[model samples]
Target chain A: MSEFDLIGRYFAALGPERSDVVLGVGDDCALLEIPAGQTLAVSIDTLASGVHFFADCDPEHIGHKSLAVGLSDLAAMGAEPAWATLALTLPESDENWIRAFATGFGRLASAHGMRLVGGDTTRGPLSVAVQVHGLVPTGAAIRRSGARPGEAIFVSGTLGDAGLALRRKLAGEPVAPELWHRLECPEPRVALGRHLRGIASAMIDLSDGLAGDLGHILAASAVGAELELERLPLTSWVAEVVAATDDWSLPLASGDDYELCFCVPPAHIPVVERLSETLGLTLTQVGWIRSDAGLDVRRPDGGQLRMPARGYDHFPAANDGAD
Target chain B: MSEFDLIGRYFAALGPERSDVVLGVGDDCALLEIPAGQTLAVSIDTLASGVHFFADCDPEHIGHKSLAVGLSDLAAMGAEPAWATLALTLPESDENWIRAFATGFGRLASAHGMRLVGGDTTRGPLSVAVQVHGLVPTGAAIRRSGARPGEAIFVSGTLGDAGLALRRKLAGEPVAPELWHRLECPEPRVALGRHLRGIASAMIDLSDGLAGDLGHILAASAVGAELELERLPLTSWVAEVVAATDDWSLPLASGDDYELCFCVPPAHIPVVERLSETLGLTLTQVGWIRSDAGLDVRRPDGGQLRMPARGYDHFPAANDGAD
Candidate 1:
């Protein structure tokens, strides 16, 4: 069958039905109605085989990660999920692979109330490009430049399991099943982001590690930060691994965590603590924004510890990942 | 430099400024404000290195064509272009190539009053995926299912030059300069499309040849069509080539013309004729919609001609490019 026909049969019906979608699949363009007094949030991400995932990884996992990455961006902006479009390139037409991928994609899409509107399929090396569209109240989006000096820095969920899992898998070492799952399907904190829309002063999603991503907020806000190393949240698996190996860098500088790192005024700590308990999720206070102009990692004894300036660089040779 | 640094230096400044864009580059997500009473129109298209164009083709042309394809879908929907996001994947970082590409992309974006909101850059086999968003009046979008019997069929501009140019280039034959230009930089009829918003009964853009694309409209409308072979608008170059080769199929079955094929009530023909004169474009009366359930091409001598059922399929071995 033709690529177009294959898409219509396997992927068209995957999109959830919605009233706001005036036009969906089978049209040149999809029409969406954005309510008055709302702003549309847009982000795009592309994941390539071998570079973004193992070539032999499950197609379902690939699909989940592809959409999750884009949604994570929406979450960081405190936007409610709405619609998405996928541009998929495949090496060949494989029916089984397509079916499994669509299942994974549809499951997450339906859960978040996002609908697939339009996309194109082409022939090439395997890669998935997803563009997500969401809506937020006008002027209510959490921005990277809104943090101020004396604000407390916060991070949602645990960190470093995905990077650790990747390292162990690459080195031919067996990893715990929980760590493996973390690597395969990281959760995006969409609900927490929505709840924090007016409370958090600044926010970002940690796809490229906590240190590097926080550095973006600092640079954009023109402030500095001092992170408490002992307070950095880690999963049991990551903590055990770090204690045995005497390496604290993975949780601090690893990539692909997909958690939200945000900032709030110091006076709002009590409210945030209550929110963390209510959600049954760990919201760790790891640092504080400062008036100075550089980042510092502080030890329990109040001394500074030497660390790398940044995180995983896609172009490792240039060490350019540091902001 | 890292992928992020390369993007910051090259593409971060490519987007033009607009008031509706609440946020642009360097954010987790870009924020856009859709005006009240307007619907957002979305479309996506991807171009692979070898599948869509020559692997070593000019980066400038690739950039222009990539955005143009997505813009064409918006044009077919009769939406006014507003914003676009690009997800670019490259085999390696080449500063010169990146500069040329941004120049081409930014030029077209400025002309159409569209802003580049946000996107991701990744390392992989070369591909360019663009998602375009536009605004249209709610409930007034032109759709493929609106055609009725006895309506006059209209096509904007000439067709088949891109496909003909592709064939010549593949065969290593000398092609006319105008034909080569048409293949590389076909224009999207955005202005004409906006003008035909309420006038056209059904509308679609010609991407995969007239025969195959029109079939989409026929299937959606549950109708058939009959075309006059001699009435098709062809450029001087295409006409000369057809006369010498006796090949009418090029204009009928070739793809990538990027022209509009629309249907209008017979009574509205005079208004459209005036529109064509005012716009300085040739809007030819190519055919008419019918109540029957099959497509037909009539010769000048009033005889039916046999033609292929569809046009170029991506998969030639399976003849899947044909509709």
Candidate 2:
């Protein structure tokens, strides 16, 4: 396959078009419009073949997951996604792989009204880098440092299913179809994140699991959290396994959930709960913020569950439970 | 070195803080302000090691050239660059190499008043993908489709110095410091491009030499071009070599020139010429747009110069004269 064939997805057959994009592709640059009183939110992520996923995994899943991780960041910022540019590196130009990748990326982008503007496809080891641009009304973006000491910590949707699937796959065990789906197509919580601007004090997407991602909010806000072990929103499979083994790694240390972990002030709890009900999402109140700067996990018997004191690191140990 | 150390260029040690960036690194996304009445120009490019550059090339030059290519795209649109995001993949982290790379990248970014807003770092074969965002007044961006049949074609600076350096290095010949610098740190034509907004009918950066890059302008404008073989701006070394060997590949088909090739209407030619003089740049008038849809190279004796018909390709054979 020629480079032109792979790049055709942008100039001829990409998804969606926005009024804001004056020049979409095939230009030196894509010209975009940002309305007055709005801030542009930009997020970039790279998914390496062996580091992030198995090289033999479906290219469609690689496309979906690569874009989803960045969209999850936009969602955490309470921004509306508008455009994305991709930098794809491939060892060889595989026509079928490019088609399947475009299929996955275009479908998700069209669902959110996001447009693929411009990109460069080069020759190299397989890797995908996606940068997404979003819009939010100025002063309304949710930041990690806005969580007050007395705010309530909340999470939307079930967690750990993707992590469980990854663990199973790495262990050479057969994963259930539903669990595998969660790993391959973790949806970005865009709808809920857009609605969280006024209600949530601080927000972050759970890309690196609860313990590491939530720790960012705590450190940034100069507050702590006390989480209830039983209050976490978990799938039946993860919950049963954790309860039987007395292990919390599935829900706490594992990553790739793509769910939203947020902090809402006590005063806005009722409002956010109502909004979650309207959106038909399970809004679990798992914890509360504290004045002291530490995280405490309370067990059902009222004893503290101890874990390591760590946030995010650039490179982590292989078996640290984060893929 | 840990991933944290490699990614710290954005969070702590990168240069130049711009007022337009509201929230930079250490957050879910970078929040930026794009003033109304302006359009945002975006361009993304990836430089894969062993393909774009030798695997053992100086890491500092790799950083400089990677960002420079993306900046060249923004310059072609006559936009003022504001921010950039990088997604870097590396097989391993080398602290000294990273520091030198940051120094090279930071110096250029600070020169343009562009900020490093956010990015991702991961483990993989070495590759650097930089996406630059710029601002231009609404409807003022220079597009390749704007050129007319009667427009005069011009280019900034000399061409083929980088291509000569590459050819020499590959053939195990001595390369002068001046020519090697051309390959290592080719400057983007930002200064010349910014001043040609209204004066130029169409513009593009000569990253892929005249034959290929000019073909883009011709194809986009649906016009042909008549280029004068004697009028090409060539350095002393390249001129001597071409005169002795009768080889036109270096000046016509090689890539990585990083100069501006633009079209100006007959009436605006003098205006752009005077502006180039004021800017202290050598602006050479090498060609003119024609009504017919094919490229013609006229020799000094009035005969047509015959060469292959080709534009840019994602991947080409090793000896295509493009680096």
Candidate 3:
């Protein structure tokens, strides 16, 4: 059978049922009804074998990570998940592999209320490109340029577990199962992001580490920040790992956390805290936005702390793989 | 500089200015205001190096073809182009190459009234995946499943030049400049497609050759067709090539033509003819849909003609590239 035939058999039936999707996989284009007075939030991400994941990684994990990364962008924008299109390139058509991959992708898609609308299957080196479309009220999307001076900076959930897991995996050292899971299938805080929409002033997802992604918000907003190192939330395992290695930089600059870092006014802190309590998810205030020019790292004793690296970079050298 | 930095410098400013796009690059997600009562049509296409094009082909042509193919899907759906997201993977960061590519892509985007919203830049084997979003009136999209028996089959423009060009390029034979141009930059019939929205019964873009793509519409609509070999609209050069080789299969099975094929009722034939005159495009009625099951080709002498291979197959073996 042809590549198109394979997709029609294994992937076409995986989409969620939604009235908004007027037409789906069979057509040259998928038609979706965008409700009145709503804006569409769109983002695309490409994950390549040996670059974004291990070449020998599980196909199911590859599928999950591919969609999760793109959905995180919608979460950061505080948009309601709606539809997605996938462009998959493979070295060969493996029926079992495609089935597992579809299952992994379909499960996450159903949970988030997003439907697979259309896609293309091609033969090439293994790679997956996912473009997600979501909806938000017109002019109501939270952006990266709304932070102001004196606003509190916050992040949802713990950090650095994925980075630690990557380090251990690369070194062939023993790793905790939780850390491994974080490395393989990082959860996107979609619900928390949607809840924080009108509350947060500026927001960004931490795919490229806290320091770097927050730096993006600051640069866009024309502000700066002072992060209190001790206030950074970390799990017991991460804390222990950092202490054992005398390296606290992992939590500060580790990429692939996929948690949200946002800023809000001081007056809204109570409401945000109440939201945190209601959702039973950690929303730690790690820093404050300032009118100054650049980011500063501060110790609890009022001394200055040095940064290790800015974050993960796709083009560190000419021959390296992308993030 | 990093890959993100490269994108910020080169690609961020390439987006067209559109008020519907609330946000462009440099954000977690790009927000687009969908006009009330309009449905969004979306399609994605990926062009991998050495698979879709020669590994050493010009980057400018690669960039143009990448976006054009996705736009053709919108044209086939009778949707007005609106926005696009590009996920580009490159083996290395070549500043000059990137600048030319951006120029080629930006020119077509501006012409089509589509804005570049958001995308990812990655390092890997070179590939360009473009997802295009277009707008159409609610419940007005042209679908492949709407064709019926007794409708006349029509196609816009000439066919088989791209296929002829490919064959010449592979065999190290001399090719006409026009044929080479057609292979590199076949125009998508966006305006004509929009005009045919209410007139055509069923529509699809010719990507995987006429026979294969027309087969898709037949399978969806549960109908058949009879094509007249002598009635196929062809350029003088393609006719000469076919006569010299004593093979008409090139025009019948050549991919990458990027033309529109549709079925119109007998009553609408006059309207289509008027449209063709207005657009100065060739819209030749080459066949008719039938109640029978399979496609039949009739020669000038009323003799039945057998088809050649059913167009390009991505997985003919395990090592071939996708069309």
Report the C-alpha lDDT of model 1 over B61-156, residue by residue, as the tens digit: 888888888888999989999999999998887878888888888888887888888878888889999999999998888999999999999999
Query: Candidate 3 residues A64-152, lDDT tens each?
Result: 88999988998899998899999999998888889888988888898898899899887788999999999988877899999999999
Best by DockQ: 1
Model 3 per-residue lDDT tens digits across residues B1-323: 66766888878866568988889988999998888878899999899987788888888888889889988999999999999999999888888888888887888888899888888988889999999999999878999999999999999999898998989999999988899988887788999989998999999999878887888888899998999988999999889887787566766778899999999999999999999999999999999999986888887678887553244677766423323
DockQ of 3: 0.66
The B-chain TM-score of model 3 reads 0.96
Q: List iRMS for all predictions.
A: 1.3, 2.8, 2.4
Superposed by TM-score, candidate 1 places the C-alpha of residue A105 at a distance from the truth, in angstroms, of 0.4
How does chain A of every candidate compare to the true chain A by TM-score?
0.96, 0.95, 0.95
* Model 1 docking tier (incorrect/acceptable/medium/high): medium
- lDDT, candidate 2, equals 0.86
Q: Per-residue lDDT tens digits of candidate 2, residues B182-210?
A: 99898998878788888888999987779
Tell me the deviation in Å of residue A302 in model 3: 3.7
Specify the CAPRI tier of model 3: medium
- Global lDDT of each candidate: 0.87, 0.86, 0.87
lDDT of 1 by residue, A83-134 (tens): 9999999988887898889888888888899998888898889999999999
> Where does candidate 3 chain A have its weakest 10-residue lDDT segment?
A314-323
Off by over 4 Å in 1: A300-302, A306-311, A320-323, B306-311, B316-323
Error of 2 at B146 (Å): 0.7
Shares of reference contacts reproduced by the candidates, in order, are 0.85, 0.83, 0.80
